[model samples]
Target: MTSNKTDLPYFSVVGIGAGPANLSLAALLQARTDQRIALFDKAADSSWHSSLLHPGVRMQTSWMKDLVSLVDPTHKLSFLNYLVTEGRLFAMINSQFDVIPRREYMRYLAWASGQIENIHYSTPIEEVSFVEGEGFYAISGGAPVARSQHLVIGVGTRPTVPAGLSSLPDDRAFIADHLALHLPTMSSDKTAPVAVIGGGQTGIEAVLRLLGAGFSNIKWLGRRQWFQTIDDSPAANEIYRPAHQQYLQDLTRGTRRRLVEDANPTGDALTPGVLRTLYQANYDRMLEFGEYPVAMLPGRDVTEGVLDGKDVVLHCSTAERLEQHRVAYAVIAVGRQSAPVPFSAELRERLDAGEDGDLVIEEDYSVRWKGMDDHRIYALNRARFSHGIPDANLTLLPVRAAMVINSMLGSELFQIRDELCPVQWG
Candidate 1:
């Protein structure tokens, strides 16, 4: 809670988190010498997909979908560059697929992070508030810093656990986020059944990992009638084309949300290959012995579960009937919620008053706050409702980074037009 007014040599852009999204931004800004930028991560080191990293887990998207290719294909720090540096570029080319092992991808990201300067690791951003006179933000924590230009909040998502299970005492029930670290410690006794909840990518991946770990009995509970596959058709991906940007702009809010919801099953769901692998593994294990019996409890919800002696008694309500299953542990692969960013009382007050609360920005991603015309705060993942589905996911990291950089440079550095799309309608 301290403030300082000193003439600094550089105009700063402060990023709240050091995930792939913010990391991409840091790389883009690093090329510019006139501006100084800083990236902060609360973790001791850079990491992604910590859980669901089974022995053979592969990336759903190709290496071309990395942080820089979609934005700047020519960037030397792209994943292709990392592949070449690691001597895996030729091996990857021979594989005839763009995807690589998840562990290798993490290694690439870590290597890229090391090449960037002014990144503060192990330092968490506690709070960010604006100073009126300076027309800048005061970021407190990890060596006090302030920025006179812009602040990007890319903290990423939080794990979403079921409402009732939050207070459960059993250490056996876990989320997908911690699955990798905790899975190895699990007992391998055949009597212990592992229940995996959810049928999305993370859930399916977790189930496959558990089976790979030699777990005998496992159950998968999902609300969907069956596991869905993402639509990889060229026409479907056309939604990402520049022509569709105008279409997305014209739609109303409700229409835009519906479009996202409808398109999610095809774009964000589990890949067909991953699903096939899971099915094949289940069959293989079943043929050898009744070792990995995957009971697909579709259209079912886990109403209650508690520790009953040495087992977990799970009460589930299916579409037709209520059933119970006893298992050793449960893994909730429910994915994540938006991460919280600390805003000062002054900014929060303006949002509370509903004036400049729903701040609108032109396609450049400049945020409009009350009583502020020149000072713009650029938020990355927080604009999902306005910016479409690409805001939070890694799929749009490169595009978003290019836009942010373009806006900062006050010109079309990437040659993208400034036209805003039509307002979406329901």
Candidate 2:
């Protein structure tokens, strides 16, 4: 009757990656049960997109959508509580920002993580394998750290560089994250032009930072015909509510997928505040220098390119014509793909996946996998097509976490209720 750490009793849950997704789940489940639950993250410290915390850059999502507030407003870990405890509630209210700074969100996450129990930092879970008799063994550091009855994958995303830049040395082109680090080492010549490829918010932010730093020539290229902002209109917001999510559940999978594509502006678009700021900054520069520093190049689908001497050449196809742009540097701000689940080969085969080989996440965020009788696998921020926009957004994090917790416990500890909706969909 003895056991090592590998043979430890089955934990209630083992969450991979202590990002907001799994942190939300850990927060909501704190009071519900005394059963063992823990989060293991590869990062040595609690830093959420640390390098991307550019100055004056704010969160695209609202602060009210903090980890636990949306689901349980009265929860101790609510953002309001964080503000009060840190004695910055009044200062924050006076700032009157449309959205909170991402730095604050990161701090809040770290605070929440500190309060929670059994979070293993710097411990990267190498593989997760399932056995017939046992629940799930999560291996890390060449040993099984814990056995879990349930698994939650929240590995999050990484910056992606296009294959076109593969031939270039690392010194030339890089993802948006390295921009801040690269800036200090760059030449101080103000008129030296740079390019930000990809029209999403990240690209917009990069363009703004360069403009602010006195770069007279900056190219902001996006595939969309024109840069778009998040449509926070009342009607557009209707889709983000739980009622619409329930409606999405009823539609055929194909229809839901199509609608999810159409609902892009709800979360993935640029924020109006940032947009206005960029325009105003550009206008002020025009008044002072008689020309705007930032050039907006929309509808340019950058397919391939090469390094030409001191500059990088980007070949893009616009609707009307094909063109080549040369710049001192290129910043890739394209959208990110989901981080792959670290499921073992056997578990991967047993799990149901779509044509793209992505895990087929169910409505409850659970995956349909064979040989996982009572054990379950829940993926957070990995089901954009299946669960609509909310799947990859922070707007409904706690709600999703609560649903997972309920599913894991086989009881509705938190009743999900969203009534009196204005929009009705088939």
Candidate 3:
């Protein structure tokens, strides 16, 4: 339905997705009350890292790196505040690490979202277009409605399933995203071997979870020699330090992009301690009950897989460079790919063409297009290639949110840009 101008906001900032990145922006706007903002997500409610939420999975970043602390350290809704409210602050301080459980972190995010007003859950922005002279138009749940001023596209990334594996029967195979929720319902009598693809955190976590759940005969296959560890050392995390902000802000765009790609830090992966615990658990189970449910086949690339009779056979080439071995059920955890925005063909064409596209931003988190002089269409996840490493990830979300807000307010709240770090990876 066409919303009346009186009913609609005159200077509204539309947030496309309600994930942590955009949620941080929403929280900032709510805190400042500078502009009329409405945040939307396709999901029914707020969720963070639901796919990898095994019982013991915890955040890789400390609670201090939450939605607002990096931008405004004194923010009340910070993770520290959440821990205090939960009565875990004192105990958490005594622990070696400051991370909270994934479930608890998710709950804290949901709580933060609830406290913010004007956030519309389950409302997905279908398309956004700039109206000549009349600000912008956002087509959400209904007819195209004009929203004056700005728009923020924070839709996030889509799960990256392998190219050949999409045709597999849904009942037989699953992605890491759906495994946790659906694994319990899977048939218990089947002795079929399960193969998990990808060497990333999700793949490792999936293997561990399956073994923990009493599943037998699970194979974890990865194309890489070994899973790469994140640079969590105090010195490395200096990328997020305030001192590095000037360096990042002054670097060239191309250099910034290279730095992000080379870093390739995957969060929430099992630490050395956690990996040891998982190995000990598997070993204990094997020794006590004569059951070894898990096996690691690193440096193996999946060439092909097909449903053979009652079981799925995964053809994999290992480091030994031998022929492929067939296995049943493949869980591809290769991670997500960047998804294109659902804009009209005209807008897409305009974006592809450099003339209008340059006006379309690759820097700062805001989405803007050509011809919309008075309005800016800022993106939360779209400018990763341009804005550098911190755009999509939670690593610099608090700072990114502040930057977007500052851009909207015509202020310089966050001037930190991407800097070219020494090439640590080849």
TM per candidate: 0.89, 0.96, 0.87
Q: How close is candidate 3 to the true structure, as a TM-score?
A: 0.87
Where's the lowest-lDDT run of ten residues in candidate 2?
1-10
Q: 310-383, model 3: which lDDT tens digit per residue? A: 57777777767655545556778987866556666566555533342443454454444465456777777655
User: Ranking by lDDT, best first?
Assistant: 2, 1, 3
Q: Which candidate should be chosen as best, given TM-score against the real structure? A: 2
Model 2, residue 209: C-alpha shift (Å): 1.5
How many pairs of residues collide in model 2?
A: 0
Candidate 1 residue spans exceeding 4 A from truth: 7-10, 135-143, 290-292, 352-362, 417-426
The alpha-carbon root-mean-square deviation between model 3 and the true structure, to one decimal in Å, is 3.8
Shift in Å, residue 360, candidate 1: 6.2
Clashing pairs in 3: 160-336, 248-417, 249-417, 314-327, 366-378, 366-379, 367-377, 367-378, 367-379, 368-377
Candidate with better lDDT, 1 vs 2: 2
* Residue 11 shift from truth in candidate 1, angstroms: 4.0
Q: Candidate 3, which segments miss by more than 4 Å at Cα?
A: 1-7, 86-88, 91-98, 241-256, 265-270, 289-291, 319-322, 352-360, 413-426
Q: How many backbone clashes does candidate 3 have?
A: 10
The model with the greatest lDDT is 2
lDDT of 3 at 424: 37
